[model samples]
Target chain A: MEKQVILDPQQFDLTVTRLCHELLEQHADFSNSVLIGLQPRGIHLVSRMLDKLQEILPTPPICGNLDITFHRDDFRRREIPLIPSVTNIDFSIENKKVILVDDVLYTGRTIRSGLDALLTFGRPIQVQLLVLIDRRFKRDLPIQADYIGKSVDTLNHERVKVSWKNIDGEDRVELYIKQTHE
Target chain B: MSSLSVDHLLGIRNLSVDDIERIFQTAQSFKEVINRPIKKVPSLRDITLANVFFENSTRTRLSFELAAKRLSADVINFTASNSSVKKGETLIDTVNNIIAMKVDMVVLRHASPGAASFLSKHTKAKIINAGDGTHEHPTQALLDAFSLREKLGELNGKRIAIIGDILHSRVALSNIYCLQKLGAEVLVCGPSSLIPKGIDSLGVKVSHDLTETLLWCDAANFLRIQLERQDSPFFPSLRDYALQFGLTSEIMESLNKSIIVMHPGPINRGVEISSSVADSSDSIILDQVENGVAIRMAVIYLLAAQIER
Candidate 1:
């Protein structure tokens, strides 16, 4: 198996800071803007973005982590799913703009489930999707990312894995393609 | 395996030491949350939890329901008498219907011992065994353990005696497993018939005399008589059982001064334990009830996390 690096550690940080600034500029008032990070990698990304937002603006956005395992579409097909991390959103999302953050956008099923889970809290005025890497694959739903770091063209069987030094002890993006046995 | 997940909490017998400790630590976190002014957490927000009670239970059912709600999870209450189960539907069918509604967890209390385990195996939703027959009440045991840990600082080397109808009380069975796992010497005291044979295999001592058992323990857990057990040949009469095994004020005073009294209650005032002892300073019955919610919160939270992975 061969692994290819797309983004280095420093490059990833700059892209995230740029995304944070762009998001801050869009929600200029910052009164009803909140960031909800999807669990695992997105949580760390949200934390980093939150830190950058605090330095740029007088007040930072309210942030939370969400685990959408229970709301997955293929729950019956799996043997028992492992418990995910806690979803901590203290403020109500009613009439507020929620920016859902994730590390990678693959099939978009996770974001769909995240939307389903978020609806149970309250009705949001709008929800915008954000992803570090937007691999151009056929999405099962009509959903598309509002803010994308980079668009990468890839085959259907290939996988892109993002590792952060703060989380996975390294900062790199690796792409792995499925191998066919002869 | 790097991680383990329980589909349901049927009993403590099958639980590993690490699993029990994880629940305790999670409950400890909720205990801190309980002391806060808000008294709620967003850990389980947007999740839906269903409480399915086949038998009537005010204390156990309410505690679990409140625990779920306090976690910001939406709760749906289902009673056997009001549901299709009363219309001759089987327990499995009823549970399956709830699962179809996409509930995240099910807190069940059935009159059968392995009911929770059965439901857990059948459903995708997580199960918390509230009380099932005389089999086991894992949450009650967790609460009992929590209360003991609060008072004694640790469960190691504590001599605890569970007194009264062991054969018909799920609390006794659960406490036995939990206490033994936590490094406590457990003693069972009651009429010979109510004490199951071969209970010593569980590393617990059996004593027929209450006075002797009281003298040898630091805590006494009294179990209530199941009115349904009265017809069985287990005992001659309720009066006789009371006179022989009951904890009167005088009987309590005769024991070691530091001994704590406990009962998984809705107490039969003067039947198994005296009213004086129940309300005394040495009694932790209320503490057990209060800890029930926190422990259950921990169980749901940990189990939910595992299922998410």
Candidate 2:
């Protein structure tokens, strides 16, 4: 396998700030909007975004973590069982503008499951997606992020790894290309 | 990513400690699902399940149905009393006919022992034993243990007394296997006749006194006397049995420490446990019933993933 670092701590910090500036431009004061972090990985990005947004905005937007394990289309199709994470939405999303945040946009299947899971809470007036990294040309579904930090082109055999300081004790993004034998 | 070690949940004896812990972990997630505003998931949208009960059941049947529905699976119920089983149809014939309808799984409860094991060998669909004669009610034991673990943390070394009708109670046997596997100390307390022969060989302590057993344990699971399974009188009379083994609130209040109480339902009200005790705050009988859905959902969800489809 080959590994290449695409973003170090300094570049990652600037990308997050850029995403937060774009979010402020879209949802002005954020009175009628809610922020949702997709569980397992997306939560990290959303947490960092919340801390950054809290500094600029007078009031931080309503936030919750959504787990889409049950709504996934690959229930019995996977080799290993899918374990679910916690879904903690304590506020109502009725007629509110909802922004779904995640660290990476891959095959769009996770976002598809996230959409289905979000509807269970309540009906949202409109929904948008935000991601730190968008892997171009890799989506199985037509899902594009409203707010994007960076876009990278890759093959199916390659993977994108995002590490946070609180979790992996670093702030960096890397691409891993799996070696194959023909 | 974790899957069950076994394809079918035949009994607690067939399960490992890891399998039990996995089910509990999954059930913890499902418990959250059921509490949500929309208590349904699309995990098992394509799977079909048939609840085939050859005997009468109230909670187990409904619990299985609710669990399947919450997972968004297609379900069909079959009761032997109203079905072709009353007209001399064999067990294999009835189940085979159900399987012919493209059923992916069968939750079976029959009067004969090892019925689920028998059906699994012959049928193409996965089998989950709801209850089979006096053998084992694996899900009941699971939910019971899950509820206990929720109230009290980690059952390791905790003394649990299984009181009343050990011989005819499938719950008792399965509980013994499950609790022991989780490192809990188990004591079977009942009349000598109902306590079964050579039960100590299973590594559980046997006692015949109710008060003594209560004083010696952390939790007491009071089982209803299986009057339907009793061929002859095990004791003198219902009054005499109540005087000896009935769990009343008075008995609970007399204890130095408050112990958790449980009952796998269709409680024999005034006989095995009084109404006051069953309704008291100390009892987790209702939580046991509620956890029943989550535990069954976890079992079916895990087993369904193992299906070739």
Candidate 3:
């Protein structure tokens, strides 16, 4: 099985830096903005982006980690699922602009559920979606990322894995395509 | 359209007053079931309930496990130390694996708020949150409410003081919701730091003085201080905490004669509450523990019956 490398560690960092600058330029007032990272890989990416954003912006946005594992749409069928990280939003999101961060965007089911879970905490002024990699697939919901790092066209059988130095000991994106048996 | 299936018993905050009252009424039926000679029922026959405990919780976990078994359900015990959860399996993945075995329910306990709520969304099996961090213990609240109902016959206009580590105690939060919904005047008394901010917004009064709260309430629900607090900055010193907020025998004597004492044990004998008060005639601590089984049985039975019907 041949593994294709998409984004190297340095390349991923540059893309995140560019995204942070773009976010600051558009928003103008970054004080009220908050970055919410989806559990597992998204959380690591968000932390890295937050570090970059802190250096660029006047007042760094409030960043929190969220785990939507329990909020998934297809819960009944799956075996014992891994308990995701804690959902820690100390400050209220009532009127603040929230940018949800995720590692890879696949079916967009996670993002949909992430939005649903966000609503339970409080109503936000606006919610912008950000993904490290956007593998354009048939999305069941009308949801799109506000900022996307890399767009890769792939078959339904392909799987993308995002590994970070902070979490997975290595930083790279790998694509695993299912093989056909003759 | 029917309501969203309450797949998990997270807390009373989301539940309407009617829904809470209905659960209490159902619990009353199970209370009768508990009084029987067999003290067991076949309501949950052949059902499997997994007790996934990620934290050290003995009473709540045991009561829940017993409740499920009393209903004739098979109980599987999994602790954080022994389970594959220690080997990097995510909480959801572990739960998903268990659910694949066709388990009917998951009674979870984690040392983080909203843990059970998070689990409920990931699994199709009904979730009974045994205790989730300092957020809520719905069944404990249900049983506390049931015990109160059994004692007073009515909760409306009754004054109840919840003393001790309110910030870290999910029991206090659940009791506040249950007591307030049942028309009881809830007062939370503890150290300034241990008292969570905005708790007054829950329609309960907050006080730092324990004696004042004791005099004003008909019942005092004392919460146990987690041993882990010894290292935390929540309190200045254990001796100071005991002097300021602890429920001593002398303090219990000063309270109104009709006032009852309640504690969600395992009691810290000399701390938070003294031995005399814990063993006092007015103390309902044992009753709370016993009622825990019946109340949990009621919750499982009610939730399961809802699915069947």
Q: Which candidate is the best by TM-score?
A: 2
How far off is residue A37 in model 1, in Å?
1.1
lDDT of 2 by residue, B1-309 (tens): 768999788999999999999999999999989988789999999999999998999999999999999999999999988998889999899999999999999999999989999988988899999999999999999999999999889999999999999999899999999999999999999999998899999999999889999999999999999899999999999989999999988898888789999999898899989999899999899999999999999999999888876
Tens digits of per-residue lDDT for model 2, A54-154: 99999888899999999998776665347888998999899999999999999999999999999988899999999999998999999999999999998
DockQ of all predictions against the true structure, Cα-based: 0.05, 0.68, 0.01
User: Top model by DockQ, which number?
Assistant: 2
How many clashing residue pairs appear in each of the predictions shown? 11, 0, 24
TM-score of chain A of 2: 0.97
Against the true structure, candidate 2 has what lDDT? 0.93
Off by over 4 Å in 3: A1-182, B1-5, B229-231
- Which docking band does candidate 3 fall into? incorrect
- Rank the models by TM-score, top first: 2, 1, 3
User: Which candidate should be chosen as best, given lDDT against the real structure?
Assistant: 2
Per-candidate local distance difference test: 0.83, 0.93, 0.79
Per-residue lDDT, model 3, residue A25, is 82
Query: What is the Å distance of residue A147 in model 3 from its true position?
Result: 81
